[model samples]
Target: MKRIKNGIISLILILLIFVSGIPAYALEARPQITKPDLPFISAHRVIKAEPVYRVLADDKLHWYTTSADEFNYWTGLKGINNDGIAAYISPVPLPYTVPMWNMVKNNAEQYFVTSEESRDYVIGKYGYCDCGIMGYVVALNDAAHGNAQLYQWYRGATDYVYPALAELYGLDDNKWDADHYYNTVVASISSYKYEGPQFRVWSDASTLQEIDVLSPKGGETLTGGSKVNIRWKTMIPGGNISLYYTLNPSEGWSVIDEDLENTGSYEWTVPNSAASKAIVEARWSYEGIDANCYDQSDQYFSIKLGVGTPINWALAFKPLAMKALLAPAAPSNLTAISNLLQLKPMLYWQDNSTNETGFVIERKSTGSYEKLAQVAADQTKYTDSSAEAGMTYSYRVKAVNNQLSSGYSNEVSKPVFKKPEIVIPQSEPGKAGQVNMVFTLDQRDYSVNGVTKTMDVSPVSLEGRTMLPIRFAADPIGAETVWNGTDRKVTVKLDKTTIELWIGAGIALVNGVSTPIDSENPAVNPIIMNDRTMLPMRFVAENLGCTVEWLPASKQINVNYPH
Candidate 1:
């Protein structure tokens, strides 16, 4: 009778495996369970180092694990597909272990605990209920023995796990590839949050923690007097960090903040200076070791001169009216700012409406404002690359939807400025008895009366104005030139015209009358080049009764003076 009973039990086990689709060989020995010997803990059976498998069903990720006896006895299991193997421990604490408690609110939002205080605080404050302990994990990173770094990421209310640190948002040290994760999360839900590295656990290999700089992210054109958020991330243990910035790499670094807590972010007020190649660095040091670990921007960014003042966003705002169901409220705090990179004017405003499809931007042109562009809903900023340099423009933004549109916000104007370009008018060839001179940009050799001549300093374009050595420019055109070392002034006399210009000055005197060197570009003025005085080619030559024309094909400037 005992043999018959054993035979019936064996037949039932075989039938269960056949029905559940769990292979018979999958019935491995159950994990050895151990109860915590601590006196404070009570009424518990906690499994240690239990193998856990992640399964997908009903369009949601779920964690599944069971003992060997339970797996053998289970029958007709559906929607259970083993993706990969993972490990977990119990609530009971062990040596070099931390208890990971399960907390739930609406749904499971976060897991992978840090301390009992944190768990209890969330439970009491966030209305989360304690769901008992999930498992224990290694407290510190173990490098000698290979172990994987588990990452916890969540979207909406469901928390998911990644086998490796980089798997979380496809991010690695100095590399940010959020496109795949963004698409996945955005398609499924609206909100996504990243919970940084949790406890280290056993795996095939150990991942080295690194510090990664996340922003200014290179190629950004930041303006002076504006506050910028320098952001970074690190998995290294808590230590004192320092932040530094450099306008030019060869000039060394200036401290933005020193001995700051490793908070991963800092607010910096940009200096009132312009730089084409700017970099930011974040350094982590512990135990008085300088340069222990550090990371900087992967590529250089730019900081340009602007209105050296912060925009009072609150003061710039205009009153808002109640929103109607058909349309959103008008945008507020519209302001246009100028930057040095490409001289593009940046327009910023506050999004005041929730139902608008998009905002329409208009620029004042000719006699009235015209539509410039339309950006998607909730977009409060726009860059006007089409704005002509040296031209002042006014802009306004308004909310719009399919059915209706909101009123335009308060208008803001900004005068865009860019590095000037050499401008020469179209002119006919010089007549006989005229001195014709040709100078190519960046070329030291020029021609006077069709004869080749060499100059110590090259003719170049600076701030959109053509610059040439005063002697080379005026002497070839039958103009007598004099330089005043004390006043840093250059005086050119040709026939009855007299032109006087001061170095670094935007205005020049022509025939004793004050005149701008270049009206279109205010920054166009005289400068010193290679220990020689350089004057604006167009301003000096034209004032001396000469005609100037630009040769685009060969980048040559032609000056003709009637003799």
Candidate 2:
């Protein structure tokens, strides 16, 4: 029975072998499979360090790669790129890019295949078709992102045609076989092999961190000024686009720019911190990556996460530092003046800690702020004595570092007040220490838009028994003043404009035209008590087209143009 059972099992095994037929051994162990000792062939590449083939018969190029794993790394002759651009070894060497032929001149080696494999293709195995096809590739380049370099193999007057190539938009020159022409590079691989240890890689994850808000970026620092600065840095390979910002760098920085979805970087403010504090960062996610880091080429620092090392800033922000953006055009840095001085309300700003030139001393009137001055490359300080009395004026100073400025300084102002009390000893005859003379008053109502009233408060005459004479200041003619000269007539010439007055020879000459003196020309008397020329007050003012101002408390007079 045991022998019969064993016989049955053996018979089953034989039957199975016959039914399955000899199992085909298509695959071998990793080490057992013999690698084909094929000669290695390589060419200047647009994508992967791939294998490019020269049709041993006709040298026209086609997509060629030994393995599909490196497909993403390929772009040119081996890519089948939608752009149809490829690169080839140039036949003529170049010291630099000879754009005359629209070819990218990289300093790589060159070689050639048999004429039978290329230019001689039509009749020969490799002829015109191969040459033409290769020639077409020589002129192709990556227009997608403008990176891949394509090269054509040609030796003729064939013109190059660029597609959507803005950089080469004006490539018109084509020198035939000259040193200036961009010659197509080509060389057939005399030897070939399968390169082992091929490497295709992905990046490590990255991140950016939000740092701290800084102090005055060096300009005005007014309006709660630009004293508070924004700060941020990288943290992860993939960050939230919602983490970017522009105006407000301090408050909730999560709300990023809407355009962040459409663009790679967001706009941000820079303080004129002399580049010491000026920095901007971009944040985004790179999904599914390894062996990498996130950094901005235009910033001052960077952080590498792959290594457990605390970023020393040497490599973190090294290759990508934009130090120029930190020096901003000054905006709000200024000095507010609460104390008004008599000489002129001179504004003096705090010297810039950054010590920069090209400053602007802007002033705000009342509560309204506008560009008061646009002084460029200016040093500090400005005099503002032109302000009216009793008017509460506000002012602030600002400094500019490079093009960046700080916010306005705190506003400083004071009400310029004028006195109104008057003590007049009656205008009677025969008074002590009195002399008759012409007078004019300078009283203005700024609250009502600088409206002023002028009247003759004088009995200026030598025939009087001595009355008080009002006081006035040094002024040009055309105002109310007394002129008591012994001469019978007075002569005067108006300023350089279109006016001239001569009150001599018993006639008044106005602009070379003779006319009688108007009664209003001398509204006051002419009294010569002291050894001075005293005459009617209104004659001097009205003759020169001036407005009068009088202060009652001080009994002072002033004359001015219609400013």
Candidate 2 on 14-90: residue-level lDDT in tens?
A: 99888678555534344567877443121111111222322110121223222234233433222124322123322
Stretches of candidate 2 exceeding 4 Å from the true structure: 1-323, 327-343, 375-378, 416-563
Backbone atom clashes (below 3 Å) for every candidate: 5, 96
Best-fitting candidate, scored by lDDT:
1
Q: Evaluate model 1: give its lDDT.
A: 0.61
Q: How far is candidate 2 from the true structure (C-alpha RMSD, Å)?
A: 32.9
lDDT of 1 by residue, 1-563 (tens): 99999999999999988878976567777778998533211111112245434443223433333244433332213433444445433222333455566554322233445577876655433334444445556655654321545555554311232222223224331111111011101133334465545666554322333567788767899988889999988764566677777676544556678668888889998776777767777766432223234677877888878795543222332212212222455776576656333268878776656678899999985579999999998787889989887688889888888766877888878778544222222232445557788899999888766667776558878776688766787765556777764344689998899888866567788888989888998667675542345788988888777899999899999888876
TM per prediction: 0.26, 0.21
| Model number with the top TM-score | 1
Q: What is the lDDT of residue 302 in candidate 1?
A: 86
User: What is every candidate's alpha-carbon RMSD to the true fold?
Assistant: 30.9, 32.9
